[model samples]
Target: MDDRGGAPAPPEKISAVPVRHPGRWVAAAVLLVLAAMLVHSLLTNPNWKWAVVGQYLFAPRVLHGMLLTIELTALAMAIGIVGGVIVAVMRLSPNPIVSGIAWLYAWFFRGTPVLVQVIFWSFIAALYPYLSLGIPFGTEFVYFDSNKLVPIFVGVVLGFGLNEVAYMSEIVRAGILSVDRGQTEAAEALGMTRTKIMRRIILPQAMRVIIPPTGNETISMLKTTSLAAVVAVGELFTTVQLIYGSNYQQIPLLVVASLWYLVLTSVLSVFQYYIERHYARGTVPLRARGFRFGRAQGGLS
Candidate 1:
């Protein structure tokens, strides 16, 4: 025992207890074998028409459509996020009427089918042929066909972006709510304006919560752009449809689109992981704790 003032120290630590889980090893081997078999089967399958997939993977028409899809996704997400934040803020307003209006907007958008909205907008000329700009009842400075004003692309954007605003508003609202009430109170006590508090204090912290879901929504928005096909917007899937229609090779063409979507989503997922890590600086990261990378000590084999 060391001759200090306190009781004798305990014996020096001998070793960590054995962390045994034989079942895990067995499960890993089984999963590996199954994965190998699956890969082998996929490679050997003759009907998959992998050559066709490779041929169309980077086809010109497909690339054009991909560009359109990307454009639509970017526009939709940009507008949706901006509109969503506005709606989320309005939903949190102290005024009952403001909050009620925001609630109704969210409810209607969320409740309706997005496809219906797209089709409705696409044929809006039938509903209201002329959309006049000027005072509502006094003056008509200009007028244009509803369909011409809200063309197929604009219609698709309205459908997707408007619907997305509802969902994204909820996501933003939830993130904002996740911030401690004390923070808002403290900011108020400091005589900060509501806008300033939201911008500088609350929103920055809320972003740690907001970004992951927003990333997910962005990826989802990418896929959701496919729905614009029904509105005759020439997006990636729609381009694939046009190609397959001509050649009558629907499955192979679809496989091509699938590959592109998978690649894009995979890239986005990696981006999201880094973004999440960036926000999670002060917190213990789950990835770092999941698996130890260095060489292990002697095992009880």
Candidate 2:
């Protein structure tokens, strides 16, 4: 049954695919209700004291403590990252003893609470009373005062770095394991040594997996430094506590500390997003060119 010059057409058929439910209206209603509640709360709250918050915002001690917090976070993260890589490599070593040692380190540090470790390091003198340094088979060459060993900075770094190493070791191990086995085999087939294979081929690919979790850990570590307040380290929160204790403006002073933490975390999150995008360049789908807001138009008339 050709109408003009074409051959007979196939029979028409109906499609069987199910239509997806559109939930935009439901979502919009929920969002509107939330906005209304937030606006009402802001209007009704009695403690919206901007003047009090502004009064101590730039106090010298507060600024100094903020700087100290940044310093502690940087130092601890640096040591943790370096030591974590070493422990991760050792855990994956061919030697049984090395692997066992790394395993034990990760297990113990991760199992214990970080606050307990901080207190222990802060009060190490109570147990040992002195520190001796020398070769195992030789006489002690140097003796240090135990009282000087557990300074505020030393205690914070030791506690944070050791705890971070345990967590980062697991992150690194997972990153290394995520590389395909065939990649190693291919590198071997090309006459690359184990070290070269790991450095050039495996690690590059593993970075994709490593960066995201590492960023999250970095943010967590920044916040965890607040725990040092318990040991009187004079970081941001401790400084806030001192101020509030003396001045009795607890809410505003505490709010300043909270705002600083919020700002730092927000900045870290932005960097994390950029780092993720850089590593994810080739693995994920790219946004289509000129595809604005779910519309597609480039067809000819």
lDDT of each: 0.89, 0.86
Determine which window of 10 residues in candidate 1 has minimal summed lDDT. 292-301
Model 2, 1-301: lDDT tens digits are: 6779698888789888977656977888999999999988756775756577787788899899888988888888887888887898889999999999999999999999999998888788888788999999789889888879667679778989888999888888898899999999999999999889878998788889889999998899888989999989999999999998998889889889988899889999999999988887778754422223433544421
- TM-scores of all models? 0.84, 0.84
**lDDT tens readout by residue for model 1, 162-263:** 988999999999989999999999999999999999998888888888999999999999998898888779999999999999988888899999988998
Worst 10 residues of 2 by lDDT: 286-295
- CA shift at 162, candidate 1, in angstroms? 0.4
lDDT of 1 at 144: 91
TM-score quality measure for candidate 1: 0.84
